[model samples]
Target chain A: MLSVNVRLFGTLSRTFEDYHHSCGLDIAIASRGDIHDLLVHLDLIGESIGMVFMDDKQVNNTTKLNDNARIKIFQPIFGG
Target chain B: MNIVRVDMNARKITREIFEPAFTGMGGRGLTSFFINREVPPGCDPLGPDNKLVFAPGFFSGSTLVNTSRFSIGAKSPMTRGIKESNVGGTVAADMARTGISAIIVEGRPNNGQSFILKVDQKGDVTLHDADQYWGKRTYDLVASIKEFYGNKISITCIGPAGEQQLSAASIQATDRDGRPCRAAGRGGLGAVMGSKGLKALIIEKSATNAEPIQDLEGFKASAKIFAKAVMDDEFSAEILPELGSAVLVEPINAAGAFPTRNAREGQFEDADKISGEALAQIIKSRGGKPNHKGCSGCIINCSNEYVDEKGEFITSSLEYETIWSMGGMIGNNDLDSIARLDRLCDDIGLDTMSTGVAVAVAMDAGYKEFGDAKAAIEMVEDVARGTAFGKILGHGPEMVGKHFNHDRVPVVKGQSIAAYDPRAIQGMAVTYSTSPMGADHTAGWVVDSNLEAFGGTLDPFSAQGQVENSRNTQIHMAMVDTVGICDFAQTGFGAPDGLENVCKMIAAKSGKPFCEADWKSTGKMIIQTELEFNKNAGFTKEQDRLPRMFYEEPLPPHNKVVVIQDDDMDSTFAF
Candidate 1:
């Protein structure tokens, strides 16, 4: 099993009432789990995800996760 | 459609049929084309020779959703170049419904007096002596106008900043609620209006005369499809309506492009406190209105009414760019202070983006410490008071930078750059450097296409596809602005057959064929005209480059500097 840290931003964070923005959430997943598997575990499937970053680099749902990986998820954003 | 020409010097108003050559033109297309042909490129922007034009989008008065956009054009006193500052308010629809295509204000008043132009329900134009409103701020002036001229009208006016002919002055327009919070807020066009001795333009909201559409049924069908698509898109339908444009704060910060402390840093430690999530949460807690509609026929409702802790109204809409300018750019994190600053800028008739960045530049130069919200507020208030330092701040970042001898000022052609940092997003570097409108993010918002998570094809830090992406996006955005489509609602164009549906609507209204190809060409024509004016006005490829800071200093987190070559920037307009 691999432990991944996840941080949600914008409206996505509001879904988890007790979610800490700075501290993020820690979850253990299978060693071969990708972003899709991680989203499923977090119950974020079908959510309007704007961008996702793993260790500071943007990643898609199909990208595989590694041990101690840090993930940040955001709602779709439009600029002014 | 008719054009109303007001000669300020003669105090004469005349109505004539719009030029036959501009049959299908509207908004920026009409404004740019007119300014290019009539105004000399080298003419002083604040002199008698300059003209201020107001034009609504073709779909403004039609039964289309989210089309209340208008273009206010003039030679910029700041950039010294052609400018079409687009704004959204009830005035666009009201003006269009009066069957007036454009209102052109020409020449300066010989008597050095101020006046207001009133357009009645019958579309008759008249000029009135407005000496009483000469130095009033926008909020007070708007209330006075409503008290005197009834509440059922839309007003576009300038405040003390414009009256002073400040380079960062903006023309404030009334929103759906009769609040003059919407602004044609760039290029210092309000200074042009003030120089012409025009204080305000009042249009009767009761006017119901709309231009005839050739195929009403077909237009309505396409309109419905476009509206549905806007309602269906995730960014337009859900996130924006829930969080407003402030939703960009977190994602952009995460991308290492939030631009903090006058672009000295890429990220602000306190960014989350001022982000969309926090903004919406605070509004909800304070009993303010979220999901507020700011413009006519807008279904996205991305605007919000910000209130004090006691639940009293402070500002109509606290936007993302203002949040950054007053927040991270100046190294401040208090949302309440930012909201108040937004109201102050709106009241003073100044561009919040420019005003904030000017203060940022001042803070960077050690005039005041960064994160000093009190000092920032005082500086903005000084612009209204016309204090000596206030005069310097009102002219925007370049002037402020010069005043303090600051070398890190992030600007292009006198105008301050927006929220996105070009170092982190190299595509934006190309757009910021090449766009006729200097450092304007909206001129070509290539942020989405540069991020992989947004299904972007290019790398954000690489220069490989940056120039081409910016060029295509800039051309498309030109057409979008000409059509007066709200940038947030442009997601409708992404739906299957959405672009074609828009074309069909155009054809139905103009009784002419319009396709994707024509869209590109029309956009290209508008850019070419603007470029020609700038070229003649003595702008060269050298003026298109970003400041030395962007290329020399590497932004943190990503630790990347701008890598786009100068030759690549010059190639953007190579049709």
Candidate 2:
């Protein structure tokens, strides 16, 4: 099993507050799992997660996940 | 589109035809062009020679979303430079529907009597004495006018701060709910309006149709595509309309870029307490508007009607910057207090950001204690009352810093910096230092996506590639402002084809040739005009750099200082 540290941003914290407490949630995934698998496991609104950053770099939904990968999800936010 | 010129000194008004020289120009484009052409560089901002021009954007009055941006221009009493402050509300759309492209108020009244400029339903302009309304709070004044013009009227006015000719005053505009929450704030343009003896500009809801589009079918197709893209974006659809602008508090805080306690710290411990998530929770429990439409045609709906504990409306749009400025910057964690301060700013007609920074500077200098919510409210009320102490606080951060002899004044060219700490986001340092508007965030905002989308490769902690990044974003934003697109629509504009569609809409509307190629060139033209205006007003390379405190003080969390060099700033206008 591979584990990734994930933090949700904006409305995501509220959506997944039961699991994450605030914004961060630690999840274990199968070997070579991608962002799709993570989103499925979390059961978050798929379209709402516009950008996914794996270790401070942008990645797509199909990008491969590795052991202990740091992930942060951002919704589309403008204005301030 | 006609230009209505009101000569206050002679008590005469004239309607002149919009010139071909300023054709295809609206909003900041027209205001800046007209100011640079007419107003002398060295004239006093509050003098008769300095004119106050208000013009709506190109797509205003049209069936366009997010085109209700009003550009108010003048020689700034705060920065002593040509300034154009953009506001969002129903005023821009309603004023544009009057078939008047711009309202230019010139000269000064001898007796210094207050007056209101009214444009009726039939496109007629008249001046009315404002003796009863003068010195009143903007919200009350707006309500008084609403009684006369009824609900369909849109108003742009100032409060006692402007009446007292404070340099930090902002001209407040009525939002969709007739609340004076939308403001053309920054650069003391309100003082110019006050100087002209004008209290407010009341526009009756017009019966006229949208601006004539040259290629109607083509424009419709392009506009449909653009509107669909904006409305379809995940951020626009889910985050903005749901949580409003305050939602930015978390992501920015998580990224270690949220400025706190006057930029002494990069991240605040109480960030979540004053965040959009918490704000939403509070609004839910209090049972007020969770997501309110701020402007006339704002599809994003990124503003909220904040309510008190009793579930009464206190203010509209307690946005991220305002939350950060009034909350973390002053070390105050109370969201309700911050909401009240936002309300005070709207009512008193002052820049919330400037007012916050000023209070922060004063607190740092021992005028008040940090985290003292009562003291913060008192300080703000001082500005409203026009007291001697209030006058110091009303002069904005730089002057307060000078008065208290405190060195850590976070300002660029006299205007206060926004919520983002420059040290954490080095690209913002470039934007704040070199933007012709002086420390304005809207000139160009750099989030993580902005770096990747614009092809900018830079270490945000260090100085590499930041100058280029700032230059590119600044130029692109200039085009957006000139063409009258809202920054929130960047969810669409940031897409590969997003900005192209924006240019397409403009080209279709005016029958002009503009695409991505012209985007950068058009932005350059507008920026050059602004830079020329600033240059003539005695701003040189020295004024184009960030304050020394930003360079010396190391912000916590990342512990990075603003390392962008002055040499890089000199090249910002090299284009």
Candidate 3:
């Protein structure tokens, strides 16, 4: 059992939430499951969501997740 | 059907019949064609041999939404290379309505006297004395021209930097709100215009009965479909209109692709201060409008005019690239100061992106401190004034880097890179490297990973599938530029089959038959022609490379260096 949190920004933020908050996803996975599998378990699709961070350090979508590792996901939006 | 040639030396205007080869091409294609056809290769870009071309897209006068883009082309005095800068304004539509396809300004004035070009109905062109408007900024100069030519005339003008013939000068265009807000702001086209002793071009919207299209109804149907797709798409409709393009700050920052501190890092510490949310908040608090505003017949209305606190005017069309280049890339997070600097760049006829990069390089050289908004504003002002240091800054990032002895300048083929750092977004790295224009993001913006999800061995991080993606995107963008449509319209209709309807519309209008594949081929042909022009002008595969610093420095967040090998870069153009 592990806990992960996600937050959206820009278009996703507007469409999802006003500020960063916990996603509150609790799931039971086999030992040594990676973050990619966790994202699938949490129903995240492709690069539609841009950056993923684990405990403040940037990580790719395929990064492995540890027990009780905090995660955040942000979606793409416009800028110059 | 006619080409207007304005000889600055003789102050004479000559007209010639248009050739069929140049019938459909306009904007970038037209500029490139003119440069390749008329200007001699290896000629001094700042000398009399160099020619400046102003051309509107083929469908500029039509009811096609957001099709009012015009291009300015010149052998760049800045890059000493081929240059084409495009902008959205009413001048293109007005020129099309007045039955003019292109305007070619040639030869410098022998006596060194400056003048303005006035074109009205019946194609009458006059060179008016512009000594009084000399050294005036574009904002004030535009107002003076409007006051004299009446409110309806479309004017393209330059400013003090242009009058000084600085290498970084841009050509200014009037936006919907009558501000000199839009610009062809790259490669010092304004310097070319200024070298011709031209101050401004005032075009009167003529009521001439010139209908070039053959099938209006079919064209209208195709245009409607294209417009519907853009208006209905989630990205174009909801996001672009609501936030303009500046909304990418947060996402690109989070992705660690945002260029910061002169491309030294991919993330900004003050990202939240310059985020799109901050911009939206400012717009809402100041009673500013954030909806889509059209350029000519455009319905997408992705352009914005933002006002600041104290209810004073700030800037128009506050874009994402400009914000990033001036804000994060330079390490300046003051929004109001950034807006003021944007206005200064617009008034001086300079590319904000290049200017921002140059200023940051200046800061990195210890000329100014990082994140000093006041110093940044003063440095830009110095460029407008053409001071000694200003000349260094106005020459662009490469020159600035050279003068400062900084080896980490992030330029490709002498032109500064856009907002996205190549070390972070490797797909855009391919674009910056291989693009003929050199470091241009619009050659192909490869951030569209959500488009139908084509499964393949195409990895975004590695340079594995970037070549094909860049080639495909270049073709698509070329088609969009030719039709005078906004690139945002392609979000809904960028696919091969989607372009079929657009080509059908073009065919109907031109009384020709064009299929989906024909449209695709047209894009390929445009790129091939551009590539040939660049190759002839001395560009080679060696020029198609990212700066060495990108390969050396590991960007933050991801902390990944661009590990693309030289041979892999050579294979990008393997066709």
Candidate 4:
């Protein structure tokens, strides 16, 4: 079992919980599962995520998320 | 049109006819024009030769929304470069009402005596003795001036810091509540006003029958549409009034670009303490007003008055830049402390953003501890007193950095970076680097696609296509400024035909046949003029580069440095 910690920001923070509490992903995949696939398995729309981060490093939305990696997603919204 | 010249040294008021070429330009264009034509490069900015010009935009007195901004221009005593700062207040509209185009203060008072310039509807100007009001704070001075001139008149006054000729001094303007809160607050223009021996400028509402626009009905039609669009928009209608500009805290913090602790880190650990949500809660608990209040003829009022827990006034118009500078940047999340600091800046006539950055830099240099809100407030108070350390901080961010021997100062071209950190918002980085005005975020603020379809990379962290996005936004911003409207109205420009409607509005007001091409041409012309002024003022491509700290420090979360190369910076000016 692989557990991925997810955090949301901006409009995503407003719409979804900052931390997803014990969400289960149906896929049992290798280390090469892209973020798009992860979102798809979680029933999340790709357009809602503007930027993605994995392990404190900014990665493209298409970049793969490793097992036990911490992922942060930001929606397209501006303040000020 | 006339130029009212106030000579504080000789206590003389002279009126001169406005040149025809300067007939249409106001606000930024008028100030930039005056600086370019009149001010001698390399002249002592504090000396009598440097002049400060105050002009209202063309549509300032009309029914147009967000058209009430006034511009103040002078060769900066701090940066020793061209400076133009604008603020929203009733004074600009009142000036237009008095059948005056602009007021130019030339030469200096031979003696150290300060005076006030008073103007009435009959075009009469008087230089009154202001010795009694010299050292008074902005609030006290405004109250006294109002008592003397009646509440109907609008006055722009400087505080003790300006009277002392502090380099970071600002000129304060009264808001609707009669608080000296709004400011023409940048580039030490208040010092220029002080150098001329002027304490304040009082403008009585015009009794003359003068209309601002040529075609009233046509202008009214277009302005109504524009105002409706602004008021009807979800972002402007919903978020702005509720949060003011403090709404930016969370997103910028998330992007690792919130400018924490004098730019040492891009994100603040205590951002939640000062976020817009937090501010809303405070306002609700304290029974503070949260709706938009107009400056003059503005219907889309984005300004608010914030009150403290004891029902005491803290500050009016708590903005995003102020929140970021005093809260996140200094690592002080105390809203009350931030409000007090803001009030200090307002009362003393200083730039809050620059002063905050200076204080943060001082803290980094071991002059004060991080998150020392009281100490930070004290340092700002020193600026008013002209104390030894206050003098250092009053010189602005670059000088303060040098004084403290801090190498991590985030300033470009001697001006401190605004609230947005460039490493997080790459388009903003381009704007800060390449803008003629050093490190001004408003030069080209990037609107999110959801807010406005500015059409750029959805991901702010990506450098790809940011330069082009910035350039396009800059052009649009120039057009907005030229039209004398607030950039907050930009959400309406998202529609395909929005630019055409803007042109239509201009055509109706000026009686000129303006079209989309005309708008583009005017924007290009404004940019070219600014570029020419900078070039003549000895600014080169080297000055356009970001500070070295951005390249060295890897911002957290993203852990990415400002990777835009010098070549990319050079290419920005290729246009």
Candidate 5:
């Protein structure tokens, strides 16, 4: 199992009342787990997440997660 | 619908039916077509030969949601090119309800006099003396006008910056609350109004006289479908209303395209502090209203009222662009100072993007230290005070860069680039370099489609497929602006039957057959007219290129320069 750091942004932060913005939530996932598995593990599978970033790089659902990877999840952003 | 012509030189007003050539055109379509046909291309932008036009979107007076987009267009003193800046407010709906399509201001006043134009609910047009209101700021001017005309009228006016003919000046339009907060804040159209010696326009509100729909039943049906589509889109219905446009701060910064510290850095260290989430939290804690409606008939309500710690009004509708401009661009993390600067720009009638970029250029040239919020506030105040340095800043970033001999200025044809840096998002590079509107983000927003995490297919760092994408997007936006649809409300077009429903509405209004192909053709026509106008105004292919910094400098994080070829950029308008 690999422990990865995850930060939830916008309204997603409110879902976890104990979540702190500066201190990201850490979750253990299977060594071969990908973004999809992580979403299922975090119970955000059906949530409205606009974008997901791993190590500051945009990643897709099938992208593999690495140990200590920095993950950031954001809601939809409407640019003017 | 009728077009009103105000001849300032003769102090005359005339009403005329639309010529067959100009029928079925409104908003940007009418403004660009009229300027291309009547105004001399090579004339000085602020001279008498130049014309200023105010037009509403085609669906303004209808029962549609969020269609009150009003376009103000002219040859811009800042870019020396054709420009259109649209604002969302009650004015468009009010003018449309009065059965007016466009108001054309022609020929500057010969005598050194100022005047105000009034359009009554009965559609009668009159010119009044505005000597007493000539130098008043937009807020005070709107207040005075509303006091005299009752609270029912909408006033589109300029501030002292416009009277000074500053290139960064903007035309301020009153929102639904009768506050002059919504702004046509690009292209320096306010200077053109000032050059014409026009102070304000008081348009009487009307509950009757909406543009007659030939097939009212059909129009209503299509409008219902379109409105539902907008409401169904998660971005429009949920995200925007909850977080406002400032929600972009996190995603854009995460994508490494936020354009922080004058484009030297792609991400701001304090981005989280001035982000949309922080803004909403602050507003809620301070008793400010979020999810507020600033435009008429707007259901999404992406606007907000920012108040001070004491719960006093600071400004209404603190937007994403302004937050990026005053926060990350100048390296200021203080949201309070940014809100104050936003209010000052609104009151003084200046473009916050241009003004902020000008200050950033000055700070980059060592005129002041970066992150000095007080200095940033004072420089913007200087433009309002008309200080010697203020006049230079009001001319925008290019002038400030030249004054300080700085080569890192991020401008295309004198207009400052918006929040998005082109190096990180190559599609934006193509859009900024090729757009006739001069680095305007709204001209072609390919940001979302270029970021892979956001379900975008295009590679943000690649040149392949960027030109074609930008060209199509620009064409679509030209027609979107032509029809006067708010960009936010355009989530409707993403629905399964969105385009078809909109076509039905257009066909219902014109009593003519319309389809998607006609939409493309109309957009293409508008752009072709603008490109021709720019060419005749002495612009060449060289003017359709980005500044050297974007090509040479490697922005932090991504460290990628604009990779789009010049040939690709020139081919963007080949259609």
Candidate 6:
């Protein structure tokens, strides 16, 4: 199993309110899957998440995450 | 609507018709136009020659959501360049209701004959003596004014810091609750207001009519669709209320771009303690008002009324920048202390970003230890009390660095950069160096552009392709500020149909041919004019470079440095 650290921000992690401080989780993904697949596996809707960062750089659905890659998800936040 | 000209040197008030060139313009468009045309280049920003122009946005007086924002423009005493700062509050709404295109305050008062100018509902303007209110805290001053002139009026005034003509002073404006909270908080415009010796601008709430719309029905249709888009967006409706812009804390920290300890590091060890979710949890536990609107027509309500653990209000709209500035950037994890610092900045009328960054620089110079909340709060007290030490800090980060002989100052064009660190966000590096407004986050926010999922397709760690990212986003933000709506309301404006809806509103309001493409073009024009003004004011492409420290030091955990090349930055405005 391949593992990735996922962190959701803004409304993207609202459902996990109980885990506010620990919204970041280490989850397993299939070797054949990408970020979209990982989102689906985690029961998260992709459209609700605005920007996706992999190890502090932006990533796309097709960007393959190797084992233990870090992912940060944020709602399309605009205000400063 | 006409222009009201108040001559402070002459102590005369005269109403003048706006020139044909400026008739339909408002917000940044109007403010920049007036400033670029009227004020001579290279004049002292605090001298008698500089004129302060205040103009409400085109849609401000209407029933539009998030349109209650106005622009204040002058040559910056801080940056010594053209500056336009916009704020959200009832002032814009009330000022628009006063039936004025812009209010131009020119000339300096002689003989210390200071007065508060009142623009009443019936278009009557009067100047009243304001001697007794000098040197008062902004909240108390506002309360006393509200009590005297009814609780409904909106006011814009500077505090004792401004009265002292400190470069970091900000012009405070009243929010709906009569708190002198919202601020046009950049470029030391408050010092400009102080130089004029005009104590306050009281805008009486009197207009009951909506702004005249050419295509009223069409505007209504577009507005309804846009409002629904805003209200229905998950970010605006859910996260904004739940956490506010402070939501960026966790994600930015996780990404190692949150600007910890005055940009020395990209991440904070105590990030979770100051995260928006943590703040929201605290507010909830303390029964503090969470998810409040900062302005009259704001739909997102990204602002909040932060309170102490005793459930007393501390500050309104304690923003992400403030949180990072006083929290992560200064190494302070105490949210209550940060809240107190926020209140201190607001009440004393100082730019929170500049104040926080200056204090951080002082800490770097061994003035105090990092993470000392007591020391940080005391520095603010020094500013409010106008101490000799406070005078040095009040000059902003550049001066603070100079005073302490520290070389690692984080600033661009004498203005301190905001929360987002350039080492992690290369697009932001371009913005920090190139923005005519000097390192402002709102001038060009491109965190999304670095994400390929949103069409960025650029590597954020290097100099490659970040110029176009910063340029496009900067132009877009120029249009956003020109339109005078809250930046969070871009949820509506960012959607596929958002531009069409916005164009319809502008066309209906201005009775002109407005289209989606005009946003970029008009935005480009405003930026070009500002750049030209800055050039004439003696700014070189050299000043458009980030501090040496940014490029010299590698920020962890990414361990990247500022790599955006110089030629690309110069081409940002080449068009």
Q: Estimate the Cα RMSD of every predicted model relative to the unseen true structure.
A: 1.8, 3.2, 3.8, 4.6, 1.6, 2.7
Q: Model 4 Cα displacement at B485 (Å)?
A: 1.4
Using DockQ as the measure, which candidate wins? Answer: 5
Please, what are the lDDT tens digits per residue for candidate 1 over residues B1-575? 68999999999899888654533578998888888888999999999888999999978888888889989999899889999998998999999999998998899998889999999998989999999999999999999999999999999999988999999999999999999999899989989998988999999996978788999999999999999999988788888888899988889998999999999899898998998888988999899997799999999999999999999999979999999999999999999999999999999999999999999999999999999999999999999999999999999999998888888888898888999999999999988888888888999999988887776789999999999899999998888888888999898887688888888888889888888788888889999999998998999999999999999999998899999998888999976
Each candidate's TM vs. the true structure?
0.97, 0.92, 0.90, 0.88, 0.97, 0.94
Residue B244 of model 2 has an lDDT of: 82
Taken in order, the candidates have interface RMSDs of: 2.0, 3.8, 4.3, 4.8, 1.8, 2.7
The whole-model lDDT of each prediction reads 0.90, 0.83, 0.77, 0.74, 0.88, 0.84
- Off by more than 4 A, model 3: A1-7, A13-80, B206-210, B292-294, B449-457, B492-496
Worst 10 residues of 1 chain B by lDDT: B16-25
Q: How many backbone clashes does candidate 1 have?
A: 0
Q: Write the per-residue lDDT of candidate 3 for residues B259-339, one digit (tens) a residue.
A: 899887888988877776677768777887766474777666767667878767788878888898889988998888888
CA shift at B351, candidate 5, in angstroms? 0.7
Per residue, candidate 2 scores C-alpha lDDT tens digits across A1-80 of 89999877666765554754254688898998998888888887454565577876668778999788889777755553
The 10 consecutive residues of candidate 6 chain B with the worst lDDT sum are: B16-25
Q: Which of the numbered candidates is closest to the native, going by highest lDDT?
A: 1
Off by over 4 Å in 1: A1-5, A13-34, A54-70, B20-23
- Give fnat for candidates 1, 2 and onward, in order: 0.64, 0.38, 0.24, 0.12, 0.62, 0.50
Model 2: residue A9 alpha-carbon error in angstroms: 2.6
Rate residue B122 of model 3 by lDDT: 64
What docking class should model 4 receive? incorrect
Candidate 2 chain B: minimum summed lDDT over ten consecutive residues — where? B448-457
- Identify the CAPRI category of the predicted complex in candidate 2: acceptable
TM-score of chain B of 2: 0.97
- lDDT string, candidate 5, B442-516, tens digits: 999999788765667899999988998889999999988978889999988876778878888888987888888
lDDT per residue for candidate 4 within B137-181, as digits (tens), equals: 998898888888888777888987777677778999887666789
Pull out the clashing pairs in model 2.
Answer: A76-B235
